[model samples]
Target: MTTTNDTRGVASQELFERCTQIRQLLAAGNANFHAIGVQYNLIVDTRLAEKAGFKNAPEFLTQQIKELSRSTLVTYGAVARAFSAEVCSQYGVSLLNQLIVYVEAAGVELDANDPSTMLISVPGADGELEEKFFGECTVVDLRKAIQRLRRPTSSAPLPAEVDARAQQCSAALTGYFPQQTGVRVEVRNRKGKAVMSLKDVPLEQMEQIAALLSTALRSSRAA
Candidate 1:
């Protein structure tokens, strides 16, 4: 994978141990992402990379934080910023992130503490909508749930050609980003739909991806 390296850096066992803590804790299961975020925040906030002679956090993270991808590190920060340490203590980090996405995308008012039910104000939703708790929602389940919410208003089902084309586009994105994690691309037959999820992409690459999409949209309009 192509990593953006910081200017020359010296190795520090202390920093290495700090980075390694993320891996070690996660492996033990039930990792508290907020705690991991604290360490990630420290490294970035204090510019710990420079202490090791590296120019930026990306370089330090990529080189020093081995095995774990940049996306995983970013999730630590997301969970820390989005939820309390107490809230995140029991929830898996991915679940927390997905819930945030679901709320934002679905316009659903949710109590993170009570995942079993939520009050979503959509076209026909009335009062508190009794729903399954989301602790077990896989990424694919997330996409389907979102789609179902908008089903009445959603456009026609994705044509097979479009689905195939979208798959190709997703593959191209993977080829280009290479190091990204937790990406999901699915073509559901029953719904004749395709969903491509790109989450936890590193901050540095986000602008590039956004710009690429914007440019494509412009060209499409012009054409």
Candidate 2:
């Protein structure tokens, strides 16, 4: 696959404008879920061009874009579509917000003009570190918070309140696995990379939590 770096002129402008517009739409809750899907298909056109040796050809880019699935296309047609419509839908809004707030509150702002970014560490079910994002947040502090929240207590099952909050933390990981359709309650290792335990819980609970995650990721990206 040949990737073109010449995203100058109209292509760049189109991407930027589309991204800005999508942000405005989503912030106002005016986003058409189906349309987002359509955009996704169009955005994937670049890949098609690369494979077809047409990466530098705008004609091929436009032509390939016309062939994507209408439903999923909108979700990736532009920068905003890819992040907002697709990534956010998969991740969740509230989770993203917490990330943004967590980072901002920690005073880890990024230089818009620079490529360098910040990193934050969140804990997984097995008390292992999961690198969350590069933002304006303190990685050490976030890791500390996740560690404090996930550690099993001796007296009880980590307390009812603690369990609930910890579950919220787990829900943030829905972005990592698309096959996770059901709710999972027990702590597990990230993608089962290590010897982590898995527990299956009520399906309804998982769906609800996943919804929150999707919303969070979307909103956080926008913020």
Candidate 3:
């Protein structure tokens, strides 16, 4: 049960609050993101949409919540299921979304008491890889971390010469890509069902990368 302590900050001399923004705002313009998300969960969970003569959530979205995109509703429920109001406000909408994605994709929970085990490679001050938690990392760092985690795990070792040649090719290609492109190329070479993926990249950046790929493929012989 949520006691007075939970809302007032500090778990009644027990736990410390990491996120202090506790006021729940449900006003249309105010957007207490996660709290609104909680309402979303309830609506879907209780079949309120069905009662409203909608075939499904998508229909409900199209008919009533014209402004709410399908993607927003999906992620909103995820955010609501994942964290409390305070954590949602503290992390902000983007981070909370990333948090859910990380946990689901990595198959691990975010344990506040044991953030050490959650350690992953993140860029340090000197621009070198350092292990850190999501809370400790900047937004850019978290994005990089999620990308690293989602990358396919190699099942077998490549021959030394092939690996070296690939590294050189990668370096060359990396140098050619402009930093402003906001595009990334990933090679998910691994045994089994591993597939390439792009996470959280904007559509404009994706279109840029797609254009590059189209140009490259046009010149190359059919693979």
Candidate 4:
């Protein structure tokens, strides 16, 4: 029974190793193919379909590579050859997948100071551009970090009255919390209800703001 268990374990380990090897090879091949597609400009040119005896490029690819999805082809082809190669080699295919989504959404810029760092610009709640940095890190970790940074936390198209109130609140608080620069209050109307939000206030600053509010309330009560 012991020998049988050992043999099974060895077989499982071998299979796992083989799968890993195949995955890596597939990643490398995908990167190479994408680089070629970009260089040849075949990804976007639908006219090439007629020459290739197909109705369209999508049709040609679908028939030729039935297993591959059209979205994957387009995404891979969209990446710049240089960036694709670097991402695939250094970060592996998993990171390349997430990087493609970022590239498509808002675009990515290489950090001037550090070649290994990628800089993504996202819109802050205060209507300012905020930079999110991804240094040398695993794909899973970087993806999670980037997703958190990019997630939209605020509601949009507030009612005119709510918007005006939010603006007034922001202006009033700016005077009290001059040290907390670049913070804005947003008022959103949802289902006839008003929701107030303070954008980008750290915990310590929030405590300070709370104290100020408490003091003001006490003073009003005394008056």
Best by lDDT: 1
- Two-way TM-score contest, 1 vs 2, winner: 1
**Which ten contiguous residues of candidate 2 have the minimum total lDDT?**
189-198
Predicted candidate 1 versus true structure: per-residue lDDT over 79-197, tens digit per residue: 77777787787666777777777787887676755663544332214424334557545655565566566454425578756655665556555666656465443334335555556
Clashing pairs in 1: none
Q: List where candidate 3 sits over 4 angstroms from the true fold.
A: 1-31, 112-118, 123-128, 158-189, 192-223
Each model's TM-score? 0.46, 0.20, 0.53, 0.42
* Off by more than 4 A, model 1: 1-17, 23-27, 50-52, 107-117, 120-140, 147-223
lDDT of 1 at 49: 66
Model 4 clash pairs?
Answer: none
Candidate that would win on TM-score? 3
The weakest ten consecutive residues by lDDT in model 1 span 2-11
* Local distance difference test scores for all models: 0.63, 0.44, 0.56, 0.53
Candidate 4 TM-score to native: 0.42
Put down candidate 3 lDDT per residue, 72-179, tens digits, no spaces: 767777877777777666667776677656666777767533333465576556657787766675667677767767776676666555444444444444455666
Worst 10 residues of 3 by lDDT: 14-23
lDDT of 2 by residue, 1-223 (tens): 3235444444555554544444444456534543443443443544433333445323433353443343223323332332344444543333333444444555666332221244566666786866655444344545465445455444423544444444554556544345555534345333222122335545556676567656655655554
What's model 4's overall lDDT? 0.53
